[model samples]
Target: MIKLMKSTFYKEEETKKALANFILEAEMLSMGEECKKFEYGFAQKQGRAHALYVSSGSMANLVLIQALLNLGRLHRGDRVAVSSLTWATNIMPLIQLGLVPVVLDCEKETLNISSQTLQSVKATDIQALFITNALGFSGDMEQIRKWCSENEIIMLEDNCESLGSQVSGIKLGNFGLASTFSTFVGHHFSTVEGGMICTDDEELYDMLLMVRAHGWDRNLSAEKQRVIRDKNGIGDFFSRYTFYDLAFNARPTEIGGFLGNRQLQYWDEIVSTRENNFKRFQNCIESNDDFLSLDVRHMDVVSNFAMPAVCRTHESFEKYRKRFENAQVEIRPIIAGDMTKQPFYKKYVTNESLCENADFIHKNGFYFPNNPELTEEEIALLCDLLHK
Candidate 1:
């Protein structure tokens, strides 16, 4: 029977072995040198100047919002344009921080917030755009970046689903002011449960460090920490227990760090396998009139998080849903479906017309397993069931 995800970790044996070694020899289990090492390696890989480790991807998004607010890059009640086809946490932080969210529609072709959607907002009050590279599919980011710059809009990326994806030689996360990644169990990499925020902005990076902890100066560099302590008129001993700003305890453990380092070693193999599976899956459904698949051929690399299948009609959805279920394959709605349909959103969002495409996707779109661990035979069998 085919399943959505086989296990928590892609390379379970190797991951457990690494964790075991660290557990035996590690001096401390808290967020420390190991977390620092993992963060540095992740930053280098993503081509960012800094990376901050957190307990979960949800926390990564939350801390990023706080960091932006703390640095005055964004303010309370500012209108933040968000993808209507995003996860709950992506919008939750915006609401939690008292920011107004203007839900943007997704392109039917890419299933992402395309440049056209950005232009359709028509709201001049939009100070920021928090976009999600949904399920490894990205829109024309180069054009979007140019537009954001011209309009003075601060762009942030929720790249939790598109970690290894790239477009025209440029990485997706690099186009925005700051971007986030998740190493959740079913994600591209598995550190059990962990997340990262990457950015080139030095001041924003410093603030993120404090935001991940309890807004303490301890995580900051000695020079920076000293400056804050001196400015606050607090001595070294007293500053050790001081909380400087609004934040949360979202730090990851050493075990999570060790697993991340080990998982990164197999990065190429993992991505290549997922991409190959994606192509094979696409080939199987290209001729099937019942389904509509997004065109991702333009993407230089695609680290597919899941395979999205948009049924042409409600009848087709029921037919395919039954087939997959009978075959023991799992399925799920696309990224929590339309964000506006969520219970929490209904209370805050009144104008549903802005999310037309998102509403269409929510009604028609569903995703299935696209993990790297599937063998060629397994992939073929899964495709056969899908086509049947």
Candidate 2:
């Protein structure tokens, strides 16, 4: 049976052996050197000033929002626009933090919010945009970035699914003020369960470090810790236990850190294989009349996380879904289709307009595996099923 994820990490045997060795001699299992090294490497790879490792991608988003709020960049009741067809965690933080969320529709082809969608926001009250680079597919991000800048809107990305993807020669996570990444079992890289927040903004970076660790300066640099403590008039004894900001205990374990660094070594090969599989899947689906393919012309490199197939009709969706099931192929709905439909959103938000294209995707889109470990035979079988 073909599965959504064949292994936890690309080099599973190596990860297990390394972890086994670590279990024997490791002195500490909490956040430490391994986590620090992983953050540094991730920041360097993404061309960002800093990267903060956290417990999960959901925590990464929560940390980012809290940091921005702490820095006075966003305030209670501030309107934040979000792609309607994104993960629930991406929008939950807005409501949790007392920020207002305005749902924006994504284009049917890209499965991401377009520049046109940004322009369609008739209200001038929207202060920020949280765009999700869904399933490794992004809209014309450069265009969207320019528009956001002109409107004085802060743009952030939920790049959990598009870690290695790029557009117009820029990495997906780097196109915004800050972006979040996940390293769950099914993501581009696996740290078992870990996440990261990457940004070029030094202030935001500093805030993230504090927010991630029970809102303390413990994770901050020695020099930074000294400066902050001195400014707050707190002596060393009291400073040791001080909570400095609104935050949580979202720190990653040493194992997550060790695995993250190991995964980085194989990043290139992993992404390349996924991209190839995406192209093969695209070729098969493009020739069939019953499916609609994502528009990837604007993407310079696609680090495809999954192969999404938007059926032309609900009947077609059922037909393909049953075929994949009969063939023992695993399948999943595309992201968290139409975020407004979520119970959490329904409780907090009132009278949101229909995000038409997002709703279309919610009703019709489903995805199958595109993991790098897929064998040639598995690929041919998947493609043959798609062709039918």
Best-performing candidate as measured by lDDT: 2
lDDT of 1 by residue, 1-388 (tens): 7677777787787677767887999999998888899999988888999999899999999999998999888999898998888999999899999898888888877889878778777647799999999998899898888889889999999999988889998887889999999999989888889999999999999999999989999888899998999999999999989998889999999889888888877777888888888888887877787888677866898778898888888888889888888877888888766788788998876655457777777788788899988877778777887674
In candidate 2, what are the lDDT values of residues 1-388, reduced to their tens digit? Answer: 9999899898899789988898688999899999999999998888998899999999999999999999999999999999988999999999999999999989989999989888778546788999999998999999999988988899999999997899989989999999999999999989989899999899899999989887889878899999999999989899989988898889999999999999988888888889888889999999998998678999988887888899989999999999999999999988877788888889999847678788888788788999999999999999999886
> What is the TM-score of candidate 1?
0.97
Instruction: Report, for every candidate in turn, its global Cα lDDT versus the true structure.
Output: 0.86, 0.90
Clashing pairs in 2: none
Error of 1 at 225 (Å): 1.3
Candidate 2 ranges beyond 4 A from true positions:
none
